[model samples]
Target: MIDGLKRPACALPVLLVGLAAVGTAWADGIPWADRLHAFGKASKLVCFLPLFVHFQNSSRTRLVFAAYLLSNLLLLLLSFVVFCSPDISILIGAKSPGVPLKNYLDQTQGFAFIAVICVALAIEAIRHQQRGQAIAFAAIAVAFFANLAFVNIARTAFIYLPVMLALVTIRSVRGWPSLAVLVAVCVLVVGAWGVSPNLQFKMARLLGEVDAYETNTMVIGGLETGGAERLEFWRKSVGAIRSAPIVGHGTGSTKELFANEAAGQTGIRAKIVDNPHNQTLAVAIQWGAIGCIVLYAMWGAHLLLFTEGLSRRKGSLLAWIGLLAVAQNIVSSLLNSHLFDFYQGWLYVIAVAIVGGQLQRRRDTDQS
Candidate 1:
């Protein structure tokens, strides 16, 4: 394990995180109070320390797996219920009708993953001739997909879900069967778009927002839409990165960067933001080109590791789960800084650590 830490890919994320803390503490211009606040948040990285341990016991691993899956299923059911009933939604005080916990983006991302997992599990159950279990899993997957299509879903979910579906189809079937599944997925998407006004509205809004941003007509009815503001933030963040393409402004410097950029500006251009909403830009703002390299290297390493883990027959489901998490993070990070977000970050960490540990244990046993 210690030897593994010496590997560049394995070591860089940890090293960069430490650097982030130090950079935060020593960042100039930012008040000591603000710097200390950032440092404290950085120090909370210890919360994930327990992930270093492997769940070597099969029973315990099964329990953890069941808990994870069931919790997601529960969330799916609750969200669906709320989506269908405005009164219950209001009673629960859900800011978003379907999302009882967390915001829409996080919940939708989670559901997308769960939908994929349920599909994979269903395939496995069918392969094993467990018809009842297969039926249940497939039904749950349908519910998840329906919620994503008819209820509130993050815009990023539309981008990644198709990729995930393609991966799953390729993994589970091949040749004509694979082609058929892909076609079916496309038809389902088109059908949902036609039948679900919610999907149509969201898609239309996304297109309008992009057009508005490009045309510099962001303010409609005297208020700025979030989509245009996000685009403006990305534009400014790119300029900031170009200004300091090497070491960056320092950790916790994004707020200050945006503050400076917003100075003497007007409208959306004047809006100050802490998160540029893009993960690469977010990291590059703090650590620059080096940070981007380390960030991508870590993603590439985990992705490759999980891809290899798929060849291990004993626990390939875990590998699939890990792969989905990593791939989702990579795709979604293009639009949102999910890696820095508490729930999404922990999800990524837990999926990688648990699956990687199991694969390592299996490799050791095979070697012996």
Candidate 2:
């Protein structure tokens, strides 16, 4: 039933389009609609808070975990359908990709959450020697890579997923040649790239990105894209940060600071940046030097707890899944606003907190 509801290409595509229009405010200004939208998205993370809390009854915790898993599973299926059915995606407000498979993710940034899920799940499946499960999870992940309208998604598919498979799959296959698994993973990833136009398009954009940014070149063919925009944003953001090195502009004020910097200015710096697009810079911008220290300390704590969490069980599966899930947030934050993002931030915290909570359980278990 949930999966059916998730489908953008439902029997009632008209209703789906109507809902999309409402979400977009019909491109018309509506009082407090934006706030309502924000609240709804926020609730996705907020609703899972109790899952982070200690549950004396094991059943409740299991149920909550299952619910979260099912929701993402349905979403994966929905994304697959949207990818194959271009018309449905178009109705749901995907402005780019021409075919517009951007149905539920809103932004390509949401793919990070999906990646964490896929990687963690695949690790678990591999640990258990579940070939069918591993294959299904991998295929779904590949489908996501092909259809999601982001260059980074393709990069993620090629780099992180295969490397993860190479390392993590080694744990399960003791008798077979380890290199075989790595070779197969590489072949499959490259084959996915061969079939996926999305990956090809992103690669083409990257080639001219430098020239586009340097010369204000819009169109040489592929969407007038460039890596220079991020580099430039970083350069200007760093320069502005030097003025207030100790304490930042304050939380949630990143865009405001950028606007202030860009006021009456021209060129790329003239445009407001949503966040520093770098988590380290984002924290520094929000809380300055103190924030960075806090972030590092928090990571240490999370790592320790995740380790302890894995110590709860005998198998190495927990360690592999926990680390893979947590690492996505940290790595993505380096270049994009993953950790600090409202949607992504909640996800990062919740995943770590769950691991932390499990670790705590093990401590209690060991003590008692």
Candidate 3:
């Protein structure tokens, strides 16, 4: 409230998050730092809530959105150069091959959002008969998709991309047009799969990793693949949640719980991870069912804010942007706890607050 977040829908989540933090501080075991860690990450929404008022200025909001696109474009250019020329990549001090900057996960996620933005903007350009702008935006969208297919890939992007495309298509078109566009998107995905060995390997490896984790036979040189590690985390998380389902083991308890489980184990099972890699289970382990309710309620409230009473009309682009961001976070959260991570958590909070503020402005204008 002090931060100027007026809507109860918005404020409730912040309030619950604060309460969760307090509860964590009170929870026994684990150091104070560990106790506050998860909630501290969540408190960013509250910390940034004050900026919501500023985004009500449509011009400023547009500027922020433009900066996001330009920055991502720059990252894409550098990534392509690094991916194509290893010598240049090394000269530039790029740490990982093909990924010139952040890990594959963050890059793919950001690029997926860029693809959504380009497609939405391209549709708007076409509607206005701006053929040049439409083509440029569409080409950029395809370029980002190409990076995911041929260059470094994150399996999470494959999840975010289709959900985002379907949402954009359904919101932008109706009836047969929607179906046709969706069909085209599917065909493009299929074509990418057929062409990109990287894509095929990732897909096939996903199944193999899961099978290996289940069979307990995939360890090599005392290391596990990301997929296998995630499976192991999820399984252990479920057991921990069952140990204290209602109120959870309290804040900052996940590591200790995991440590106990991992005790006397070897290989991947011996790995004690603070994060379970799934957002819902992450909360459920810390705060149990009550925490989970608040988490889902917060997500549902934001989704309603962006989706309900919004349509493909003039000035609806802000709503579409907000909806796509929410969708991307939700879909990706299934595999990784984006809200717990610094970069992605802030990205989600900032996108939602800015767009939410602008949408509220539009609603106030219509009412007046």
Candidate 4:
């Protein structure tokens, strides 16, 4: 309430989050499915949805968002700069027994989250023309880049880059020149991405096992031995969606359904990995087409708001940043489990809420 974000339409986000909370709460016959990670996510969204509207002014909205943004950046800065993770005990020299030290910050999903935020900040800096901020963000960008390419070597990390570039293009002035410059920058990104050691390893393994599959082979062989198992999971998920195309199999049923479908399939790891690692398919498997629609509806609403802000062109730079953040998550979901991923989902909700809040504020400004 302190920041001056006032809009009755703000109820939309809260309503959707609440609906999601109810859906997860009552979706499964099993107990505590709602209370588990998904419900925990819903609860957090319910709590956070109002904060955006609470901040009424652009300056204050930016301040609140910046505080959280800085913390994410700082966590990334520390994660790479230090040899050991923060708040962990040393195992050898300073052996404290119970508190063992680990280099990984497990709360944040590796490198994907931090990289997009850094990219968003960099864009913000350039748009606003804060030279010092731009230079500092550029420095920090390396840490994110290194973490993505070297330490994490995540595919989603690679996917997020293009999504961000697309988002920036939304507000491009001198459009052709910006497009040309972006194309040149992409050349360097692709070069670095190609050379990443982890990527080379994954590509090699995937190619080695490709011959095992037939003309229409969803069943990839040598899964337990080590190969691209994600394809199988994705295929099975698609099959499951076909089974219950409209309503879906229901929430929290991905593992059960996937395991059943892939059962006795040759060379596959006969396991019920809780998540299929693909957000859309996972939803399609669990909730079917209807569930998929609702899931997308949540984002569709947010996109409308973000685009609204961009069109308004008043204090909408944040909207551009928010759009990029949401876009990164959407793309990440296509390649990773992101629907209820605690950390990433929160970021998504927060971005949408802030942008929506700004739109509400902007509406008032326009009305006056």
Best candidate (score: TM-score)? 3
Q: Residues 131-173, candidate 3, lDDT per residue (tens digit)?
A: 9999999999988888888887888887888888888898789
Q: What is the TM-score of each candidate against the true structure?
A: 0.92, 0.70, 0.93, 0.75
TM-score of 3: 0.93
Query: By the lDDT metric, which is better: model 1 or model 4?
Result: 1
Please write out the lDDT profile of model 2 over residues 1-368, one tens digit for every residue: 23322322121222322322343332223335442443242234332334334431132544655676566557556665565667876678655433234323233444544554565577577778998988877776655554553332433333444444554555546556677766786686577668766677666667667766776454466343436567667876797578767765444445655677778866554667555667678666545686576556555655554555554464245455556556666666666655545656666656554554454445556679
Candidate 4: minimum summed lDDT over ten consecutive residues — where? 94-103
Candidate 4 lDDT score at position 30: 38
Q: Candidate 4: TM-score?
A: 0.75
Q: lDDT (0-100) at residue 278 of candidate 3? A: 94
2 against 4, candidate with superior TM-score: 4
The digit string of per-residue lDDT tens for model 1 on 1-368 reads: 45557544345557657767767743668766666654444443333324534443233665776788799889988998898889999998998868998798878877888789899999999999999999999998898888888888888887888888888898899999899989998997998899998799777777777777766665765545668878998988999899878877778888888898889976677888778988999888877897788788878877887888788897687788778878888998888888777777777777666666666667778888
Candidate 2, poorest ten consecutive residues by summed lDDT: 7-16
Clash-forming residue pairs, model 3: none
State the displacement of the C-alpha of residue 111, model 4, in Å, after optimal TM-score superposition.
5.6
Best first by lDDT, ranked: 3, 1, 4, 2
Clashes of each: 0, 1, 0, 8
